[model samples]
Target: MMSFLPQLSLPLPHHCSSSKPFQNPTVIALRSPTTVSNATTDSGIQFRRKLLYLRGLNVNALEALRKNPEFRSTPLRTLKSVETCLASMGIERAALGRIFDMYPQLLTCDPYLDLYPVFGFLLNDVEIPFPDVRTAIIRCPRLLICGVDDQLMPTLWFLRKLGFVGRQAITCQTTVLLVSSVENTLLRKLEYLRSLGLSCSEVANMVLRSPGLLTFSIENNYRPKVEYFLREMKGDIVEIKRFPQYFSFSLERKIKPRHKLLLDHGFSMSLSDMLKVSDGEFNLRLTKLRLRCLEEFPSAEVLLLNNLFLISVLTPKDWKRESSISCFYLYQLPLLDVFVYWLKILGCVNPLIVLDFYTFPILQFSSIIFIFLKCS
Candidate 1:
């Protein structure tokens, strides 16, 4: 079983022969401790510190600096500290991003403008469940524009997206209240509000609350939609259509004291005719009609003097101070002196005239007599 014999040498493979192959050589030399120290120092201060610290203690030198108070306040140092603390404590990036996202850039740009308090209040009070800041940046409150020429605004569209249909409804309701209160005429504002899914009761409440909001104007005469809102809200709220509205003559843009009064008084034409008529009728349907435009027509003294004669013959209720009339608002005819005199003669002590010229009209000498007469 143990036969020892000499074997012949076979030819080696081509790849295995060292002399025929192209080979690359790499040289590596282990340095002394002084050389290692010098090499580590040349790398960087932080690198050198990390290298030295890694050899002895278990943790990095940056981790040691994190607990140092001297490097605490500066933003860069604080950031480094936070980074190390987060790494050591194993905090995730996603959670920090979620909390930081609530801070608005505008607030951050000017925090000393009391922005922090305002932002904090809004953050606490407005409990909208938005997934992130992007959602809040896009949405806000909206105001529904009504009147004959109303146009939608960008905010209105945004509000609609945010489920604010009430503004649109309010506009319609306002029109309905306007038409219903004023001589029972129908308006389109009511219909539009109804279309926006608000009830008649809602519109009535709005009218009672914001009466001065009646002065609304929109673009060149669109077919306004307010008829339904008025029809439905009728009788539910107090009638405010012809309720004694007043405007101080002092505040009027054009009309002035010492100016010849253009008493564009009672309308002889029917309501239909007046509605159908053009602006040219402003001259014909007015009270006094012929008062000058001040620049052209010299003195109104003649007309005022002649009117005094007429004033003598008429009863107090019919006292026609025609040419000298100061408050000549045609639309609000029920508030003129003629109606006030009539109301007074009919034992109306408490006159509800719009033009109450108390101090100027009633002098100190005549005041006592007037008071005596009123008391009697």
Candidate 2:
């Protein structure tokens, strides 16, 4: 049987002791329709009205607007001006959804006053075409937020000094430097480039070629790579000027290993070919080197494994470590039933490819020795 809860009585004032059971006055007050009306504010009501005026925003955007102090307090005239500004620019009605979704502050800020000069300077003063101007503004909405004299002009002048006068596609890569602060990013990076023993003109040329270099950390990326190239690779300032993209590639990953491998093999590859190519392209170049070796030794123990890799990947007992790494990466193996091809290749006695035994990165170098000895 269920235990019944005991009902206790307490004395109450004559006004409160009614026939109906008592409820909390505060609870009743809280649940009132007027209380809800009070909580729903003038700013809140205006925010909803603003949402209605703006086309294509959903419930999620409405919730964001409610919490946004700047957007919530935006004046009617300013909101009207933003709408007018977008219209004056050829920003299609459908595009406003995306534009506003990212930057609601655009609605309050006077775009005609704030943004016009930026567009004007880029298009007319710099002679950046209308299409490029449109692309820069739309692609990076932050372009609207950047000040003309303070942020935008200085960045343009810096880029102009680097010889970027009229060539204005405003690529995603270049736009990053354009929007970044001057004292910290643009000016500081200029100083670091100068420290690399480059004249102002050479530095400007380097910047023009590889705008992304400015973004690299002086300590982490620029200095370490420069030191390695100077001390290890014996590179000169002129050599760095020829290929500033050297700094873009990883020092530990691409530069050090590839340069060492080329020197060891007596194969002289350019900085561009070595650091720039995809893994497949790099392998192809190595295969070409292997073929050159085959010509040097007609009965060479080394075999060319397709046009992508060297025979050492499949043939050499000593190169089992390299072979295992290759097998893991050579994804151009059969799309369907990939592991099955390895079995067929290993079974062949002529030009034996027995290193294909393991699928996972094989640490066991014994496989190579065992296969070769058994074949002999």
Candidate 3:
């Protein structure tokens, strides 16, 4: 055709010289299994790195990949959808890293199929408010991984039967209780409290009042505190029933130190008063007790009643009103020295008297001086 078309020149196969079309070197390289595998590995690594960076996870990406193999095969769009689902539920971006690090399986969960059911149970069944759903999840990240039908629903039913209903219903603060196993954990704790002589109603009230009570380990928390309270502190079980929060205090750090200090000073306080005050306030109370000279005369009320002259001076009205006057005010009277001096001069050598200024309605000091002079 002039032979119109030019003769085509193509590289022949080294082995077969068949009439097969030549493939581009670039295309051949791209189609190689080794090259494809390397590309896929690189893409997966890049995706994992991106996930780590986006979630603020301070972890080794390779370790996470190894721990969660499913995460490697999951497509990026699917992961983004999971992130979006959590974000829509009020979970902060920063918390996602911790949550994912703790529960890497969450990374591959189908947002609708696996995740929404949990949120639904928390909202509808548990009655956790929409805003507090984030709090419940953050407080117990395991809640996200818990199965709705198997774990959560059963736990809710158990708690309600144990009296976590009505005004004493579970709240965001107590959502951690949802993760406890009814048989191994929750019921065992309840039974232990019952073994302490608490009725079912009483145990329920205690747990309702202090939700952390159910979380305490009997071997670690309950037994030690109860032993100290009974054997060392000589406290009654009734006190524990009244103040179940008593177990919440640390034995070594708080309860022991404070109780030891009180015993050292021969002072006694109710459980609530002893453990509830700040360290500074407790020390201040002890100081004031010392200043009042209460340690020297522990029976000041009885001693005051036995003093005939002091009793005679107190009119019926004054006697009735004296009950309102605190012993602190009685000891810190402004003219206490003058009263003591007058009493000493009147043949009362040891005058440990407690007087209130308002005990004499007309003239405070005048009435005391008149009474002492008239007696002399």
Candidate 4:
């Protein structure tokens, strides 16, 4: 009881000695190791890549990884394996949805929006369903759709919601093609393409669908399409490829009870060749024409027109007397002017001739006419 007054706080140094030196207080620098920073850099790299992914450039990241010395040694094949990963960064939601059943986890990830190459082929029926699809359409201002039937209409409608309607969203600048089958589908696709500022090419494989489209009609329609492809896109297309069921012509004209055309749903010709061939059926009956690559025309080859028109003329000069071709139709010829000059010397005037000249600039139309007029 004597000193009860301040027994209060005799500094208990034993209990509170500088907070026990923080337990590990030797002042451990707290600096991260280079390895830790490197690991962090890796995470930062992925984060940066995520930025690119959001910007719709995942491909560039992998491409850089492939070229960068640090990761260049990684197997290139693995890149393909990671395509799904990269594609998921900004690829079309509809396309992702197509494969969603297989990879359910990807549905929640953000998609990269790409303006696909303009000349690409669309072989499958790509469905852009509601809600999320609408968001996707809002992202891609211009889109290309191919394949037969109404499968692409949903995408069009989805796009329409994004203020891409009536040639505003899609116009001659946008392309929507319907492959060989489905009549109504072609009309729908054409309407959609025209709306998105695109004009569809009546390509070799897809021409038959545009009804009342004669050779000349097809050619006329094709010219602008070709020009658009050449000018705006420098010859490219948006693709929606699918496994096509290609059919081949029957060797026999008579339909075999069980035989059908071979099924191949892919490109069969080079880009230029495809353009040339797409206009083929149009001008089915040409007269007084100059052709380039006459030898390359399948029609000429099939009917032996080259052999009939040129080879026949090459026979003995006396045979030339019997080789008078009035109202001649030439296909795939390159030297039309020269051939015409030769024909003029032989007194072949007023003959109705059909021509399918090949590999020349359409801009030369005026010069060609002047030449023809001078020769006439």
lDDT of each: 0.31, 0.63, 0.73, 0.34
lDDT: worst 10-residue window of model 4: 240-249
Give the better candidate number (2 or 4) by lDDT.
2
| Model 2 lowest lDDT segment of ten | 365-374
The ten-residue window of minimal lDDT in model 1 covers 364-373
Supply every candidate's count of residue pairs whose N, Cα or C atoms clash at under 3 angstroms: 20, 0, 1, 50
Angstrom error at residue 192, model 3: 1.0
TM-score of each candidate structure, all chains considered together: 0.17, 0.58, 0.68, 0.21
Off by over 4 Å in 2: 1-45, 49-68, 75-84, 92-104, 166-177, 180-182, 227-237, 250-268, 295-376
Tell me the spans in candidate 4 whose CA falls farther than 4 Å from its real position. 1-29, 32-58, 62-284, 288-376
In terms of lDDT, the best-performing candidate is 3
Query: Largest TM-score belongs to which candidate?
Result: 3
Between candidates 2 and 3, name the one with more favorable lDDT: 3
Write down the TM-score for model 2: 0.58
Q: Where does candidate 1 stray beyond 4 Å?
A: 1-167, 170-239, 242-251, 254-376
Write the number of the candidate with greater TM-score, choosing between 2 and 3: 3
lDDT of 2 by residue, 63-148 (tens): 44654567666766677777677666666666666767677666667676776776776666556566666566677778777787
lDDT of 1 at 225: 12
Write the residue-wise lDDT of candidate 1 on 127-239 in tens digits: 22223222332221011111211222232333233233444432322222222222122234434334445566654444344433333321211112122213521212122
